[model samples]
Target chain A: MLLLQCPWCGDRSEEEFACGGEGDIVRPLVPEELDDRAWGDYVFMRRNEKGIHFERWRHAHGCGRWFNVARSTVTHEILASYQVGDDRPELPE
Target chain B: MSRARHEPLAHLALAAAGETTGPDAGVTLQAAPYQPAVILRGESGNAAFLEAFRAGMGFDLPLAANHVNSHAGATALWLGPSEWLVQSTTGQAEHGRLAAALTGHRHAIIDHGDGQQIIRVSGPRARDVLSKLCPLDLEGPDLAPGRCARSILARCSILLHPLPGGGYHIHVGRSFADYVWRLLADAGLEFGVAIGGAG
Candidate 1:
C-alpha cells in the first residue's frame, strides 16, 4: 500500500487520499476569447507523462487539505510534496 | 419547549452486549456520547485570529500540525492550517464564548455538538487494537500524549487523540460511530473488550 504524506496530517495510507489528476492546470483568464480547440485542449488534454509528474492529491479521510505531489510514475517514488499555493518543485534531470 | 436528542451510540446496545470475556481482556471501551465538539476556522497567520482564540479558549491555538492544546475544561486539536476541533464538556457555553469572541473576524465557528461521537479506548493492549484498523504507526513518538492525528481507520475518517496514560480517544461522524465501535470490538476480541456506559 502506498503511504502518502499529507502536508497537514503527516504520512498516512494512500487509502485516505483522493488523486485529483494533473496539477498546475490553470483556468484561462478569458474563456470567451478561446477557440473550440483551445477549450478542448484545456478540458481534456493531459501530459500523462511516464517519468516524474506533478499531480494534485486531497487528504480526503484525514485533514482534508489539498497538496501537490511530484512523483515518478515509473517508480512511484514521491520526489516531493508541497502545499497547494507553492511553486512546483524543480524536476531532476 | 423541549426536544429529544439522541447520542450517536444510543443504538449500540452496549449494555446488553454483555461484558468483555477472555483471560487477557486488555482493552476497555466507553462512549463519550454528546461531548461538545466545535470546528473553528481562521487564518493561522492572522495575529488577531490567534489572539482572539487564545483570549476566548483560555489557551493558544496549536499552530504545529497534529498537536493538541489542553485546558481544564476543553482541548483543541489542530485539524489543518486554518481549522481546529475544540472539544469540551461544557458544549454550549464553549461554543457561545468562541462565537462571540470571533465576531467580525474572518472566522467560522461550527457547532458539531450532535454531529459526531467520541469513543475512548484504553488499556495495555489498546494500541494493539487500533493497529489492526489504522495504518499509522501507533508506537511512534510522534503520537505521544498531547498530540493528535487525522487518519483512516476501518475505512472511515477518524481523529485519533492519544491519551496520557495509554489508549486513544477517537472521533468520527455520528453516522459511523457504530461501525467504528464494532470494528474495534472485533479487533479486540482476542484480547477481550469491555463496553462501558457513556461518560
Candidate 2:
C-alpha cells in the first residue's frame, strides 16, 4: 500500500485516502466562444505523464481535506503533497 | 411512557460477553455509551472564534495534525484544518456547554452524541489489539496522551484518541459500532480480553 501525505494530517496509509484523477483543471471562461473541439479538449483532455505527475487526493477517512499530490506514474513514488491552492512544488531529483 | 435509553452497543452486550474473564486479561475494554459529542466547525484563523472557544471550553483548539487538547475535563481533538470533535471525559454533555458558549458566533456545531459509541481499550495489550484493526503505526511516543488520529479501523473510519495514562478511546459512529466491537473482541481474544469498568 502507498503512504500518502495530507497537508493537514501528515503521512498516513494510502487506504485512508481516495485519489482524484488529475489536478489543476480549469474551466473555460466562455464555453460558447469555443468550438466543439476546443470544448472537448478542455473537458476531457488530461496529460497522462509517465514521470512526475500532479494529481488530486483527499484524506477521506482522516482529515477529509482535499489536497494535491505529485507522484510518479512509472515508479509509483509520491514526490510531494501540497494544499489545493498552493503552487505546484518544484520536483526534487 | 418514559423514554428508554438506547446504547449503541447494548445489543452486543459487551459487558456480558467478556466480564470476569480474570485480572490477567491482557486487554480490557469499557464502553461509554450515549455520551454527547459535538463536531465544531469554524475558521481556525478567526481570532474571535478561538477566543470564544477558549472562554467556553478553557483551552485553545489544537491546530496540529492529530493533536488532542484537554482542559477542564473536556477533550478537543483536531479533525481537520477547521474542524474538531469536542467530547467530555466523564461521558457527560460538553456539547451543551459549548453550544451555549458559542451562541451568536458564525460557526457550526452538530450534537451527534446520540448514537456514537466511545469505547476505552486499555491494558498491556492495548497497542497490540489496535495494531490488528488499524493501519496507522501505533508505536513509541507518538501514541502518547494528547494525541489523536483518524484512520481506518476494520474498514470503518474511527477517531483514535489516547488517554492520559494509557489506552485509547475508539470513537466510532453508530452504524459500525457493533461491527467494530465484535472485531475488537475477536482480535483481543488471544490476549484475554475483558469488558469491564476502567480495568
Candidate 3:
C-alpha cells in the first residue's frame, strides 16, 4: 500500500485518503461570460500526463483535510505534498 | 440538571460475562461510557479564538497536530487545523463549563451528546491487538501518551489515543461501537482477553 503523507496527520496508508482528480483547477472569474466551448473545456479538460502530475488528495480517514500532492504517475513516487491553500511548489522542468 | 443517559454499549451483556479481573488475562476491554464529548471548531491561528478556548477550558488548546492536552477532567484532541474533540470524564458539569466559556466567541461548539463511544483496551498485548487491524506503526514514538491519530481500524474510522500504560482508548462512531468491539475481541482471542462492565 502506498504511504501518503497527510499535511496534518503525518504519513498514513493510502486507504485513509481519497484522490481528487487534478490540482489547481481554478474556477473562471467570469463563468457567465465564457462561451459554451470554453466552459466545456474548463469543466472537462485535464492534463492526464504520464510523468509528473499535481493532484488533490483528501485525508478522508485521518484529519479530513484536503491537500495537494506532486507525484510521478509512472513511478508512483510522491515528489511533495502541501496544504491546499499554499502556493504550488516549483516543479522541475 | 439534565438526566444522566446511558451509552450505546450500556445494553451489551458481554461486559458482565468477560473475565476482567484476572491477572492471567493478556488484555482487558471496557467502555468509557457517557463521557461528555464536544466538537470545537475555530481558526487555531486566531488569537481571540485561542484566548477564548483557554479561558473556557482552563488549558491551552493543543496547536500541534495529532497532539492532545488535558486539564482537570477534560482532554482535547487535535482533530485538524481548526477542529478539536473535547471530552470530559468528570461529566456534564465540566462540559457545561466549557460550553459556557466559549459562548461569546466566534467559534462553533457542538455537543456530540454521546455520539461517539470509547473502548479502552489495555494489557501486555494491547499493542498487538491494534497492530492486527491498524496500518499505523504503533510501536513508534509518534503514538506515545498525549499523542493521538485518526486512522482506520477494521475498515472503521477511529481516533486512537495511546494511554500512558500499554493500552489505548479508541474512539469510534457510536453506531460502529459493537462492530469494533467484536473485531477487537476476535483479534484478541488468543491473548486471553477479558472485558469489563460497559460503563
Q: What is the interface RMSD of each candidate, in Å?
A: 1.2, 0.7, 0.7
Query: What's the TM-score of each model vs. the native?
Result: 0.95, 0.92, 0.93
lDDT for each of the candidates? 0.86, 0.86, 0.86
Quote the chain B TM-score of every prediction: 0.94, 0.90, 0.91
* Candidate DockQ scores, in order: 0.80, 0.86, 0.85
How high a TM-score does candidate 2 get?
0.92
Q: In candidate 1, list every pair of residues with a backbone clash.
A: none
lDDT of 2 by residue, A16-51 (tens): 999999999988898899999999999888999979
Off by over 4 Å in 2: A30-36, B16-23
User: What does TM-score give for chain A of every model?
Assistant: 0.94, 0.92, 0.93
Model 1 bad stretches (over 4 Å): B16-18, B90-92
Residue B11 displacement in candidate 2 (angstroms) = 1.1
- Name every residue pair that clashes in candidate 2: none
| Candidate 2 residue-wise lDDT, B1-199, digit = tens | 8899788778876666657566799988888756667899998888888899999888989988789988877878999999999877677788678877788788898887875788889999999999988998898555678888899898999999888888888989888888888898889999988887532
Supply candidate 1's per-residue lDDT for A70.
93
